[model samples]
Target: MFLFYQRSVHTWFFLCNFSSRKWWNEETVAVVTGGNKGIGFGVCKQFSIAGLRVVLTARDADRGQEAHQKLKHEGFQNISFHQLDVTDAASRTSFAPWLLREHGGFNILVNNAAINGVAIDEVYSKENNISLKDFLVCIS
Candidate 1:
């Protein structure tokens, strides 16, 4: 049996009982969107630890590259980075073909990208002693 857990607005994590080293091979691929930080990053880390070839993607190249570096520094070699903007139809439409051509095909996909749609000014947050992340966590 598998228990599905919701991680973020755009993410769902699946926990399965199946266990076998050969079940998922080196060719297994996973795409994680908005994986530069927070819950997406956590999901990417877990997938990498479980031996999936993780493609950690973000809209911003710099943040995605930073995450790739941090994961590499921590000794996770099964992970890589790509840039994707889920909200853009042009970007979304191109990803599948790109994945199919480059990695053959993907077995897992995690869509963890969403805009909070709130304008956060750091100065105001600091003055109130509540960060955007903290506020979101509290409200959720």
Candidate 2:
């Protein structure tokens, strides 16, 4: 698992070359959190195209379903959607049982869920002769 945080979104990517693995089949499930948009959505699409069953999860059900529909419209039928707020205990606890029952548990997990915990101080950074890149490097 590799996590990259940028612009308040935590983008997670499973860092294995799936194409090289013969065991990765249609029944193999990949769960992607924050799959409503951006890197998460792209990961979902790639996994779907690669013939793996993909569970696209988001904190917002409406957005998650919309993304699932978009993938379906693009002719990818292997994608499914479930609402998951990783920050909430109830949501996190319920998801495991649901995933086990629905897809026999997942083989891959992309932990792309995040909350905006950072507020950039551009003025302060400038005054201190700090570049945005330098600030990000320091924080991360």
Candidate 3:
């Protein structure tokens, strides 16, 4: 049960391993949030290539479908797509049951959707001596 944050192209991901059992591609069902691009996209690709049935999710429908198509076009049959917004509570509530029903079982979840708190202008940020925590506040 290890957790790590994978950062890519200014996007942050919360990745967790759900179980101790090793993953087998044919037997595994993986859900990767924000799979339209960056780390999420790469995760989807790797999982599909490994023979796992991967559900690639993105907040944008068009983007998600496009990413799905890109993988399919690349000749991977084990990958699929769904629209998801990880920040939304209602969406989260709906997605869980649907995944269980549709996929039969889930073996992995890669939560790659994220919110970033950083200035786009590196020079200005440096000049102002702003740290990352200036944008991210601890909930507790």
Candidate 4:
């Protein structure tokens, strides 16, 4: 049985019971968006540890390269950095060709890029020291 749980707006927990089989190798490439920090970075690290070629993409070139360097310095060799802004049409259009030309196309894509859209009341949140959900509940 396969179980999928929605942990939050930005995270999912997956559990699966299936026959153990190998499906990927060093050539299997995974592209992770917003991989310069947080959950994205963690995903990139895990994929690298699993021996898959990881393309760690971020909107910021400097941050992305820094993340890539950090991984490499830690002895991860199957990783690369690429700049990708998922919100921009031009950037997306150009990235596809570059990816194909350089890596022959990717096998997996983690669409992890995100921006928090909720406008929080900073003063109220700080004074109350409440979570976002709690703040929303109090206001509403």
Best lDDT among the predictions, by candidate number: 2
Deviation (Å) of 119 in candidate 3: 17
**Tens digit of lDDT per residue, candidate 1, span 3-115?**
25564765545465776435676788989899999878988887887678998989888989999999999999999887888756688788768877888878888888865
Residue 87 lDDT, candidate 2, scale 0-100: 66
Can you write out model 2's per-residue Cα lDDT over 1-140, one digit (the tens) per residue?
A: 33344556554444554466476788899999999898889888778866899999999999889888998999989999999998677999999999999999999998987664432344455656757677889999
Tens digits of per-residue lDDT, candidate 4, 43-62, equal 78777776789999999889
- Cα RMSD (Å) per model? 12.2, 10.6, 9.9, 10.9
Would you list the C-alpha lDDT of every candidate in the order shown?
A: 0.79, 0.83, 0.77, 0.80
Displacement of the residue 101 alpha carbon in candidate 4, Å: 1.1
Candidate 3's TM-score reads 0.65
Residue 85 alpha-carbon offset, candidate 1, angstroms: 0.5
Judge candidate 3 at residue 138 and give its lDDT.
48
> Taking the tens digit of each residue's C-alpha lDDT, what string does model 3 give over 49-92?
66789999988889999999999999989887778887667887
Query: What's each prediction's TM-score?
Result: 0.66, 0.69, 0.65, 0.70
Say what the RMSD of model 2 is: 10.6
Question: What is the full ranking by lDDT, best candidate first?
Answer: 2, 4, 1, 3
Model 2 residue 66 lDDT score: 89
Model 4 scores what on Cα lDDT? 0.80
Ranking by TM-score: 4, 2, 1, 3
Candidate 3 C-alpha error for residue 50, in Å: 0.7
Lowest summed lDDT across 10 adjacent residues in model 1 is found at 115-124
